[model samples]
Structure formats: C-alpha cells, structure tokens
Target: MTAPAPETEPTPPPGRRERKKQATREALLDAAFRLFASKGYEATTVEEIAEAVDVSTRTFFRYFASKEDVALTSQEEQFYAVLDAFRRRPPEESALTAMRHAGTLLIEALEVDGLADERMSRFDCLMRLTEESPALRAGSMERTRRKNDEMTRAIAERMGADPERDLRPRMFAAMASTAFMVAADAYRMGVCGFGSFSEAVDAAFEVLEKGFAEY
Candidate 1:
C-alpha cells in the first residue's frame, strides 16, 4: 500500500511588525548618538532627536523614557548576556577564572564586524558626555551600579555562595569588572592618543594578571 502523502508545514507570517520596531529603534539610537556627540548631551533635546529620526515625540517615549535612558538602554542586552554566562559557569571554576573566561567571551563578541572600533568610539563619546553633564553622569553611575549587582549575583551563584555566608565571589566579581572597565577605558584613552586600541587592552589585561601585589 502507498504511504499517505506527507503534510506540509505552515510558514510563519511575515515579521513586518518586528522588523519595523527594530528599524525604528536603530534610527532613534543613531540620531541620538549623532546629536549627543555634536550638540553635547545637555544641549540636545528629545524632540530634536525625534525630529532627526523622523519619529514623533511620543514614539521616542515608546523606546526610551528620557535622554539619559537612550545611552543606558542600549547596553541592557549586552550586560545581561554577560551576567547569564557568569551565572552558568561551572561550580568548580574559581571566580577569577570564570570572570576571565566570561570577559574574553564578551570582548570577542564585541569584536565582530569592526564593531570593536565603533563601540569604542561611541563609548568615548558617551564618557565625554557623562563627564560634561551631571545628569548623564548620575544616570551612568546608576547603570553601573545595576550591572555590578547583576555580576555579583552571577558570581555568587557560580561559586555556590550563600548570600549571607560568602563574600569572596562578590568581591571577585567587583574586582574583575573594575579590571575589565579599566582596560576598556585605558584603551579608549590610548586610541584618542596615538596608541593602538587592541594593544592597550592587552596591556591592561597583562597588568591585571600581574596582580596588585606586583604594582
């Protein structure tokens, strides 16, 4: 007997809504960064960015709550990705070891498609804006605090640390994050000067590896 004809799978509907949302978000981010770099963060208005992006002011609110949110909002996904990796590290791995691995993965992920350079440039601009505007600085600090909390929790979980009993993982996470940030910041500064950005990052990591006792 002949087998019954196979059924064809249904195709998914076109992702028009999702694609449009992504395009709109990118447009907003691009416009905001341009305006912030050229006009300075404090001088740039939400309406101005919305106008530049050809979006309504209400649409801007749909994506970000305020001007400061624009900068911090973009990093939310990256921050969580790293945190999730950290939390899922093997229980036997030392906090420092896990952090080193996670940091390397995070850096590698950022290096795709000449994104490292683009990200560094944007980061430097954001740093300058943060320094120039008190509101931006405060917003940046809050974002950093949130990231640190997430990292600490991830490290604690990986090390099987009890919230009330162990502090080492928390400390390790803090130090590791500081080292990574210092490396990135130094790279940014070096790039602004005459040094190679990648070389500066390597040097910073080398110093971190040598430990503070050798300093």
Candidate 2:
C-alpha cells in the first residue's frame, strides 16, 4: 500500500492576514501611547512598550520606528480620515465648506467616549509633548507639510484645476492649514476658553467661510 500523503497547513486568506497585522500594529500603538502618557514620551523606552504589549522589542520596531511614531498614529489616522471625508462631500460644496465640515467631524469623533478611548487620550499627551520637544515639533511639521501637499492635490481635483499650474488649490490648502493650526494652538494654549477642540475648529471655520469680512 502507498504511504498516506502528509497533511499540509493551509494558508490564511490575504484579508485575514492583513487584519491580523493591523490588529498587531494597533496593539503596539495602544501600548506605546499608554506608556508615553503615564511615564512621559522621552522616558518611555521601546522595550517597555513592547513588554506592555507582551511582544518583543523587535515586534514593536516592526510596527513603528520609535515612541514618536506610535504616538502620532492617532493624528495620522485623523488626517487621512479628514481627507476621506472631504472626498465624500457633495461635489457642489465649495472647498472651504467641505474642509470645514471634514475638520468638524474629525474633532467631534475625538470627543466620543468609546470611539476615542485611551488611544486618543494618549494622543492629547503626545500633542502636549510636541509643544515642549523640538524634535517632536520638527517631525510634526514635516508631516503637516506632506498633508498640505496632499490636500492641495485633492482640492485641485474638486476644482478641476491643475495643482501645478493653478495656484488656487495650493492657496486654499495653505489657508485651511493655517486656520486649523490657529485653532489647535488656541486649544493647546488654553487661552480661548473653548470647551472643546471641536468648538475652536468650528469658530475658525466660520471665520473662513465668512472670508474674514467681519474682521
């Protein structure tokens, strides 16, 4: 009699594998942020983050370069979410209107109890660190520049204009970026007496929609 063939392990579907990786990445980010918020970003070592997630340091590195990378994950996600929201807005809406609405939704999402969770609270701590750490601030600025370029192209698409040749899209993007920065800085500074970041964003967008005519 012929020997029975050996059984082979079946491969997981691509979608299942991708979801597993995403879950691991999210776990690392959660652990890193929790440690950073409690112990301070500068003091939280990659080893600790990995240990918190019950993974090796090498596994942490596979998901993120450093604590900063993990800390910024929420912000990175928000930026992309805003872009996606903008794309879904009615084509008839003006760029400024679409941007304002998108920004509003993003900030509002952060205020939701379950939706924001510990990840977002950690992001708040990271934002505070950025205010004091030059290194983190520089990294944030670079990311902002990239987001601006993306928004410029996106705006150009909405307007049916060439991003390279027509300055309108770039100009609008710059203005929107500045407006958001102003609101965020006010919230970070705690001088505006605003109840939430969403409130500040709403006020800033209102000003933009009005073309600063009141001023």
Candidate 3:
C-alpha cells in the first residue's frame, strides 16, 4: 500500500495576514519614535530603524514614505481620533460644543490606550525633531494644515452648512485645533504647572466658549 500523504500546512487567512501587517506597522512606528527620542530624528537613519525592528529598509519605506512620516505618526493618530470623535458627537450639539467634547474624548481615549505618558513623550520628541530639522518642521506644519482643512470639512458636514460659503465651520475648525495645540504647548513648556494636560485642554475650550472677552 502506498504511504499516506503527509498533511500540509494551510495558508493563513487574509484577515490574519492583514493583522500581522498592521502589527508590523505599529511596531515600526514604536521603534521609530524610541530611536528618534534617544538618538534625535536627524541623527537617526531609516536603516537603523529597520534594523531595530528586524525588518529590511525596504519594509520601512513600504510603511512610511520617509523618516519625517514616521516621526509624525503620533500627531496623525491623534488628528484622526479627534476627527472621528467630532464626527460622532450629538447632531444637535453646536460646533464649539462638539469640538470641546471631542477634545476631551480624544484625551480620554489616549489615556485608555495605556500609553498616555508614552504618547506625550513621543510628542515631545516630535517637537524636538521639528525644531532640529527644517524639512520635518515644514512637513509637520503642512500636514497640520491639511488636517485642519479636513476638520473644517467635517465641521461643515456636521452643521449641514456650505464648506465654501459658510465661514463659521472653517473658523471653528482652525480655532479649535489652535486652542488644543496651545494647551499642549503650555503643558509641554511647564507653563501649565500643577495641572494635567487634559485640564489645560479643558481650560482652552472653556476660554473659547466664553468668547475670550475676559482675557
């Protein structure tokens, strides 16, 4: 009798493969941030980051267009999270109110991710990278402006107003983003002494809602 054929291993499903790819991408981002923090962004190379993750330099480029893209991952993540939260806010809520709630929810979600401190540290690292590299700074600002425009579109949709003709949505999106950044900068600069970052954000929103007339 012929010997029974040996069983062959089955290929993993597409979902499993996709999940592995996502895990690899996140690992690369984490390693990139750590390296950028310790060695400085401009001082770090793509090959070094790839080696840290046991991946080829080609793999790194596959996930991120450049070192600057990897360095800005944290900001990009927060931008999307805030935008998503803003989109999910109650339909009847005012634009400012939705933004305030979205900001709070975004921070809370970050804390829940169990990497609040790490994320803040990475953000600080990104800030340093921005200062040290003109290319990174320009890229960061341009990306931020794009995010603001996207947020403007979201605000316009939520308000059922014309994105082109109605200026309130554009203004609200830009001002809200600026307020959040100001609070974050204050926290980073130690000007927000004795207060949590969330508190700083809350205060910024409060000032905005109050029309800033008292200041």
Best by TM-score: 3
Tens-digit per-residue lDDT, 30-120, candidate 3: 8898888788888899999999999999999999988888888778988898788778777777778877877776686566777666778
* Per-model lDDT: 0.71, 0.78, 0.82
Better structure of 1 and 2 per lDDT:
2
Measured by lDDT, the strongest candidate is: 3
Write one digit per residue (lDDT tens) for candidate 2, span 1-215.
01122234676667988998988887887777677667777788888988887889988888888767877767888888888878877787788888888777766766775454354466577777888778888888898889889999999999999988899999999998888778877776786797777778778888878775667
Order of quality (TM-score): 3, 1, 2
Encode model 1's per-residue lDDT on 54-111: one tens digit a residue: 8899999998899888876766665676666555556566666555555555556567
lDDT value for candidate 1? 0.71
Q: After superposition on all CA atoms, how large is the RMSD of candidate 2?
A: 11.9
Count clashing pairs, candidate 2. Answer: 0
Q: In model 3, which range of ten residues has the least summed lDDT? A: 1-10
Candidate 2 positional error at 98, Å: 0.6
C-alpha TM-score for every candidate: 0.78, 0.75, 0.83
Candidate 2, residue 195: Cα displacement in angstroms equals 3.5
Q: Which model is ahead, 1 or 3, in terms of TM-score?
A: 3
